[model samples]
Target: MNSNNSVFGQTLAQVHSKFIIVQVLVVIFLCVNLLLIVTFFKNECFYTTTRYILFAVTLLSDSFLFLASDFIFIFNIFRVTMQVSLCSVSCIIVGLYLIVTPVTLTAMTLERYVAICMPLRHAELCSTHSSVHVILVIHGLSSVPYAVIFITFFASASLDFYYQYRTCSVEIFFLYKWQDHVKSAVFQFYFLIMCLIIMLCYFKIMKVARTASGDDKISSRKGLRTVTLHAFQLLLCLIQFWYPLITSSLIHIDFTDLQHVRFFCYIMFNLAPRCLSPLIYGLRDEMFLHALRRCLSCGLYETK
Candidate 1:
């Protein structure tokens, strides 16, 4: 019995240590993202109207993500009100922003595709006013489904206060019943459809890249690199953020079967995406890197 108690104590200490590390990493990442956003905006002379709009959307989405993560980290550190009330609102906001960022990314990808692949007709197709209108419509349309889900889930769950030293989550509504199967099927179908669309876009892009002549090679290669990196980042986010959550919601797995180490892994999976996104863009985009370098140089000169 004494040996078993010692082992249990050691396990709990390890879990606590892991949680603290995760929280620190999350804070560092959020700060870095903020700095990147500031640097991006400061260096721009006159951003295209569409690019400005997209940046605004990205900023809003990332800000919400940062806030949600920070709140979770704080709640984990301090045993705050464990009622799901605060978290429900945060979850809804995060969900809406989560959907918004991807929709913006898809629009940005299409914009790049059109600009590069159909340069002759780009002026007619993607004017500033048209781009603004399209962005507004996309934001409104993509957000509706998530808003509906949030409302439905909030109404379905009974509000009872509970205390626990962990971040709050929306109660998995379809964990055991037939509804679990239905939800999982619908989610998988949606993900599959999105994957199909992304793959189709990539195929066309590759085809265009292959046919481009000597002078176009450099630009084509750059664009392809950008798209490839963006796709990889999105893939990482989808796998890390959505996969486990969806699986847990779908499968009625026994808690006893889950290793405690998995809990830290799950937290890392969620936190890493947000931290990595700005880093990916900074590293991949020559324009962004140039601008960042210029800004840093100017700052150092001013300090001198």
Candidate 2:
């Protein structure tokens, strides 16, 4: 009995140590994303446009998504019970952020297409005000489904005041119910359509990139690179968010059977984009890179 207890104690200590390390890594990644956003603030026209504003919104939403998910994660780790309504609202916000990201990327792709394929009309068509309104509309549209379902389902169903799982997602407490399945389907379908649109836009942009004017060639090449990055990023989002949800639904596989794999996928789906997007988007632009380099030279990033 003493030997068994000793082994159990050692195992518990190892698990606790791993948990703390994971938490620290989470905070560090979140901070790196924040730093990426900060680098965008500079004396340049890139930060002035509505397009860049929309890009910044994506960065902020990515960070906010991780913050919400990790907040629930930490609370659950500590066994902190929260009211059902509050948890619903918080998770809904996180869901909206996840949805808004791909929608924003779709908009960005469309903007690039117009700038490259319809150059004469690009200015009036892709104004800053219009971009802001599009983002607002995305937020409204993404929230509607979650808000409607949360109210509709919670009204009729019995639920505990405290969270039943670490994720604070309705699918956790609600299980394999209709609403849970429907919500996942809606998000997956939305991302699928967004992925198609992004791909189509990039295809047209690629054509324009090949046949370009002497003056337009540089800008065309830049657009080509940016859209290609967007396509890969969208594909990653599809794989991370859409595939797991769809595969799980279709196979009805026991996720618990592969605990480590599920957790790694979960962390990737939640946090990888937050770290990757800043680098992908920022580094793809020569101007942003020059600006970042200048900031580094001038000590804008100096430790104060």
lDDT for predicted candidate 1 compared with the true structure:
0.60
Q: Can you give the lDDT of residue 113 in candidate 1?
A: 77
Q: What are the lDDT figures for the candidates, one per model?
A: 0.60, 0.69
Which lDDT tens digits does candidate 1 get at residues 87-125? 666766666665566566666667667766887987777
Q: Write the per-residue lDDT of candidate 2 for residues 1-304, one digit (tens) a residue.
A: 9999997787667557646866786788777666657767765576556567777888888878877877766665445767666777787877788677777777888888998899898888877777768888878866765675666566655655344434454554353366666766766677778878987987888788788878788888888888887777766665655544654554455533343454465566666655667666667666666666667667754443
What stretches of model 2 exceed 4 Å from their correct place? Answer: 1-21, 42-44, 77-81, 159-167, 173-176, 213-215, 243-258, 297-304
Q: Candidate 1: misplaced stretches above 4 Å?
A: 49-56, 73-81, 127-131, 154-167, 172-186, 240-269, 300-304
In model 2, what is the error at residue 181, expressed in angstroms? 2.9
User: How high is the lDDT of residue 177 in model 1?
Assistant: 51
| Candidate 1 local Cα displacement, residue 31, angstroms | 2.3
Best by lDDT: 2
